[model samples]
Target: MKKIALCAAALIAAIPAASFAQEADSTEATAPDGTRAFGIEPYIGIMGGYDSYDKRSEFGSPRGGKMNGALIQGVAGVNVPIGPAFVGVEGNVAKGFGDIDWEYGVKGRVGARAGESGMIYASGGYEWVNGKRAYSDQKDWIYGVGVEVGPKDIGLGGVTGNSGVRLRFEVDTYDFDSIRPMAGAVVHF
Candidate 1:
């Protein structure tokens, strides 16, 4: 029975790997059609945002009202390009003011390239929110959608050709319990 279970698990794993695999290509920086050659792109950025907790949120204030705060965060991630689409993993740490103490999370992103060097993506992740001692700490699943616009997309192609810098804006929900809006810039390499 153990051997049978092991074989079944192996098959389940191999099936997805087999479907995504493709014929190998030469190790060149850019493909013939002018897209990125098969490689990983790593990025880092800083953002500032606001979080508004639902009135019914577990992290309520001592006065029995909703809690809200401003936050600053640093993020890092790596993306694997697959043709015009890509998949990535990202992590972030944030410091909060007002009723919040700290927030941190890790998420997975998937999206497609848009308009020269821009991207539109969706992300889902797990987050931990720490509140001031007067409030409670909570952890939940978060979901977001965001866009990144590169120099070329924003009409700076002549001066900053492929500079690997982008402007990002996103909105996220904290377990359908809070609203978060953030904007920032990211540099990729």
Candidate 2:
């Protein structure tokens, strides 16, 4: 668990350096409207939802077990605008409560701008689950949809999209069997 957390931190720290590795192309610096086109985003959010084991007991009980609780997560990713659309890759670590202990995953998103400072996207990823049950093959593929409503660029003045605080909401399913919904704020760099 510590190793996974440390790796996530290291990956976040490395993105800035990766961005600097290449010489800045004029196009990479700003969008058509002259706002910053690319940057690193670090987000923290409250994750709440239910986890159920595939097999159920006779009384419809969790064959193995189930967890109903909220967890916290920290995610870091990079975003770049391509015309009216944006692309991003993110990695996250989560600590669960109740019957769940931990989860980690990486995801990719491709979406278009929603109005001026907002975005709507669809994402898919692979996640690993650590539950109280002694189960094998806890890793599975997940898919979900989400949206971000950022603070109006109008209020930020100066650069249109250099930075802003965004409200994010999303829901994902592990192996099409269990669901996890999350919401919170994201800080753009």
Candidate 3:
């Protein structure tokens, strides 16, 4: 009887070890080569924070105010793999409101993914806004770096599909002294 009990314990331990090995094998099999063959991911997000405006002698005095607002964006782009690197572009539209004022703009970003699920990346592009129009212009450049966390098959072809949340921190120099942090989610199809 004692021998049988010992055998049962040994079997249970072996079962867990086998299961772990299977999981590791599957992860390696599905490992992304940093490329997305084809996919359509549309995301909508909101950003809120503060903006510090450098006093332009020609414009007036230095003014800093609370910057909090919402943005609705649609992204249409492709994920490509260059060796172990992942590159992609996204077209976006943003509408914002805050103490500084209200404005909207269209922008695009080009970035690479490193570490599983692009745990980190740097993206930069241009933005055109129409509203109170700070700096006596209609638009400007928007660029920043951010970190993302998700699954390795996020944009890869798979049966389970890609669905996860993303958070980004960005600083735009278009307005002389405007820094913003944005957080949002993405649904890949």
Using lDDT as the yardstick, the better of models 1 and 2 is 1
Clashing pairs in 2: none
lDDT of 3: 0.45
Q: For candidate 1, what is the TM-score? A: 0.81
Per-residue lDDT tens digits for candidate 2, residues 71-186, read 78777787766544567888888877765688889987766566667777767678877765444336767676788876663355354454567778888776556667888777
Highest lDDT: which candidate? 1
Q: Pick the candidate with the highest TM-score.
A: 1
lDDT of 1 by residue, 82-162 (tens): 655667899999999988899999988877677888888778788999988677888988888899998888899888877
lDDT of 3 by residue, 71-141 (tens): 44444444443333334565655554533343444444334345555535444456554334343334555
The weakest ten consecutive residues by lDDT in model 3 span 29-38
- Model with the higher TM-score, candidate 1 or 3: 1
Question: What's the TM-score of each model vs. the native?
Answer: 0.81, 0.66, 0.52
> Which 10-residue span in candidate 2 carries the lowest summed lDDT?
53-62
